[model samples]
Target: MSHADAGPDDDHPHEECGVIGVWNVADAAALTALGLHALQHRGQEATGIVTFDGARFHSHRGLGLVGDNFSDARVIARLPGTRAIGHNRYATTGETILRNVQPLFADFEFGGLAVGHNGNLTNAQALRRALVRRGCLFQSTTDSEVFIHLIAISLYSSITDRLIDALKQVSGAYSLVALSDQALYGVRDPLGVRPLILGRIGGGPGGWVLASETCALEIVGAEFVRDIEPGEIVVINDAGVHSIKPFSRQNSRFCVFEYIYFARPDSVMDGMAVYEARKRIGAELARESRVPADVIVPVPDSGVPAAMGYALESGIEFELGIIRNHYIGRTFIEPTDQIRNLGVKLKHSANRGVLAGKRVVLVDDSIVRGTTSRKIVEMVRAAGAAEVHMRISSPPTTHSCFYGIDTPERDQLLAAHHDLAQMTELIGADSLAFISLDGLYRALGKPGRDPASPAYCDACFTGSYPIALSDHDAAPERQLSLLASAP
Candidate 1:
């Protein structure tokens, strides 16, 4: 439920990437393309798919959205195979270059192996440096490539063993799909910090599909079987699905932000509908922070469901005080240097008629940087909003995420520096409130967060990283060197 580093101008959280795989299926590339399309929201910068027709492996990867890269019938036809893996990429560890687009293929002494990965490898820099010292030549800066290097150097008995051996060395979250001649494999981290699911195409005769979310399964007519458990490695092929536990099991800590924002409303994670969880968060927020306002206005899109929930619970009318332009690209360039902060207005416009003279509560998912909230408040004020009260569906993001989500350092986070009163003044809002940490847990059908042992990963909110940050928390010189290597 995180994205790559958006520039300071954009100032919002992003999903790092999305992944999908299919085995023992006809037109595997076409089906994979469809699945990636369903998960397009997770990432939009690049797309790739690798397929194997029991002998030769084929792949087509490019920079752009899934539809832009794989829309053509010719593009899908080129990757002919009964087994395939695909990724929608936003480039968390690597730079935004074509060589980094994954389904990263490598030929091994045993056979050909292609891998598609989601989530960041927390220990990647340390591992990369060690691998480099041992005379391994790197092809791309992607932490995913470390898997290939580790597998090549592994002395394991089988391909699966090699994969597990490689996984054991790395730390941090990952939900991966890999293709081999004999089978397709899916793996999740020990704590299930990321998401992965298992689904079957038909009742029995058809193949199996693996994706980061169940919503992708529905796009290709696959039925949800069950979630791939944490520390689980599953093999899918003509013989059917087989499960293996290669890592020591640990406490489950699924990323909680997935429910509040990242996942699609229709998609279900950990057995709860994402949309419903957000609605419950909104309802709880209304109870905790009641305000006198003429109407409730959503920030648009991500905030719509939560706003609806707030309205339902608080008995306040919800209105579209702000409208979003559906087709804005992920990044934009300013046509003129003089036009400051045009980026925000390019995507959103205030409805003057609706907002004028109205005391409004603007509902949004979270405020990673106060810049976005500040800009929105300014626009609403310009539209004659008498009072602007800001309500966030999640707790203030005070800490940085080490697992996979690209976030500013703790010092750069708005909440890390500003108290609630200061945040309200900074954002120019009459009032401001965030769903309490306990309230967020309650919305997810859990008792309040247990400080001693939290059930979910809330590092960004609590500053308690679940895993060790071997590389990031290293010497500043090392971190600078790693970033230099990326470009």
Candidate 2:
């Protein structure tokens, strides 16, 4: 569907994209398809794959979950190749539309290039303006397209050199995989604000795989090698892997939310366990915000681990007070204001038998707009909850995210709009509390220092972007011009 047709309620925020690239494989497209399935949680709106068959590039793209998009055997059979790249996108930057579905391919002077990207580009506006001035036409509003044009017009002779030069100019959290006829190239931004990993399968003449998460590797029967180091470019071809360090290495600032909420519990990011980290956050919440309660009820799915931790630490009974509707897909229609108002209730229903006459501690991952949280509180109270105390596992979101996450603009964040006391009243909760920055870090197993710093990118909470953003008010023309002339 076109972006203009999508309504606001249909445009829910999602994390960045998940990318998978495979080289010299007999079943590259199938391998990539499986990898995309494993990384589905990272993105759900659309999926695409571009494959290089010894002679030509074949591609398939559609707007929907990976499974739904590839359900047609004819669609999958059309894409035949030995090398391929796939993308599952969640629309962090641009609108969610078929035109923006990625594994974006371009027929440049050198041949064909397919790129799948994760993370937002901070200088996209400036870069797009620059590119536009040079007569570069853009089909999509996503920042990822800028990189394609940058590589297209570079002065360098080879694709690798042009890609390296193009990357040096753009800034922000990115873990990119680019496919040419002969090789697959993987790059992580200077600060490593996003996660990417490399893996291999089989023995003699084995192929290489690059994915946003290690879980993707496991799905494709590839053994994890290690994470792609920050600022490193890895090229995998028939001659074997080669590496280049174009940008200077800085302190790695992997997004902390990956551990707290975004990633699958079984997935390991930056040498840390996601499930364990979340459980620790729950325990820390109990230690710090000890509100008397009879039962600890998790918000469901993401909130379960933290709730378990809270219940264990507080010696409270853990009850499943909220039950989520598993059948609901991401793109549900809420055509009216009343339906929008009942959005949370449609997805989650309070178990009256469990919550009735009980003082409950409701645990959730984070509160962004606070609308959902408020509605959930009201639902629980309506179900006869005697008192509800809301506990957030992570710190309040105070700033906008320039990375892949689709957090609202600064003023829209509930924490930015109200103080703790005001938010408590607004959500109709007996009390409200968020885990401190230290508690968050401690939960992630990085205690004794700042939880929001040194190791993790907490820019959404601290307003300290690792990369400098271009002027926020830059004109559209100016922004497009910068993109064209990038590098």
Candidate 3:
């Protein structure tokens, strides 16, 4: 099958986007690019940066990897500024077009402002219609543009007030990094469903940094100061970093999947080390589901850390049964069915020596559609494995995520439709199991998920949506009006 036909959620959920803002730092644009490189795994389709050189806003956006676009010194030089914000975009809303690429900049009644967002706005379509009716012309189809339009139409004077006004009208998860001539701003949604951290660039009264993850700060030589609290707005400028809580405090529902798969293994989020959490999850999984296995084999890369934890906890030997080809790009072309059938091998190859005559337990982060898992299992069987049992680090992803994660429709989700036995048969594994929700909570240092107010956003697993999906849940007539009003 063609890659397009395979769809975006073949096996794993895709990250929505990553944002970074740098203020009062030398070579700010270059540092932003480096931070983008660190966050490259979050989004690969497009990259952009907008800089305020104290005079005019300079922007350069490209439709490829950061290295492919921003590697040239000339490109960095073209974006000269002391304050800047950048984005790595894996489009969840608009089509992957140059115009949709961000740090989307706009000139308002006050001054030029640029914004990079890391979550989806559930009410974007509804808000867009109202804005359009009010004669607000949209330059791009991205939901991120909704903020720009709202800012432009705000009756408030200050940029911060205008932003607060725009935020009040919206509902959904978001972590934003905005740049203005006056200051660099970072704000998290009331739920704080996505991540945004504050950091210091140097010692004493040094510069400031804002990014989607702490790892970005490390790359730019910035020390992570603290996580931007839920419902908090942090304004960073020459004077110092200031905080504003525009929204009332609510229970934080940070995306739980970030620890399981979406985030880089090394990155820390919400004060939890992702790698350590994954290991703890694997340990929990081992305790909950122990099977007769000769060796533990990770699916590779994503599965490695958890597999190690499982091995340590279960007293099973860990082996690299599947070796991945890191050099393979997403755009690898397959001109013939013969080559296309070798799809899994193009990215992964079975280590025959490790799998031969062994009862192997395959540990993976999560299963989205079971397509990749089936293929990997088949490859292991072909390589002389006696048996293959699959274990997942996260619970069954039965519901689609509307926040910022790229998930298939509810109908396309494997766990949403099938029972455990059926899923095992479909994936051609001897047995299959996933960590329980409580087990996951334990791994994260929680006793168990309190149904009243869970510690994190486990919507994808429990179907307990934290935010109202306005666009998705609109009445048929309202949805029609939204479509009809589209430009």
Index of the highest-TM-score prediction: 3
Task: Find the 10 residues in a row with the least total lDDT in model 3.
Answer: 1-10
Clashes of 2: 16
Question: How much lDDT does each candidate structure score?
Answer: 0.87, 0.83, 0.89
RMSD per prediction, one decimal?
3.6, 4.8, 4.0
lDDT of 3 by residue, 6-89 (tens): 233247888889999999888989999999999987888899999999999999999988998999999999999889999999
The alpha-carbon root-mean-square deviation between model 3 and the true structure, to one decimal in Å, is: 4.0
Better candidate number, 2 or 3, judged by TM-score: 3
Ranking by TM-score: 3, 1, 2
Model 1 Cα lDDT, one tens digit per residue, 327-433: 65545534554443676787789999889999999999989878888999999999999999999999999877777777776667899778999999999999999
Per-residue C-alpha lDDT of model 2 across residues 410-479, encoded as one tens digit per residue: 6687877688999899889999999988778777777544534467788766666667766452557644
lDDT, candidate 2, at 26: 74
Compute each candidate's TM-score over C-alphas.
0.95, 0.92, 0.95
Candidates 1 and 3 compared by lDDT, better number: 3
Q: List the residue pairs that clash in candidate 3.
A: none
Best by lDDT: 3
CA lDDT for candidate 1 = 0.87
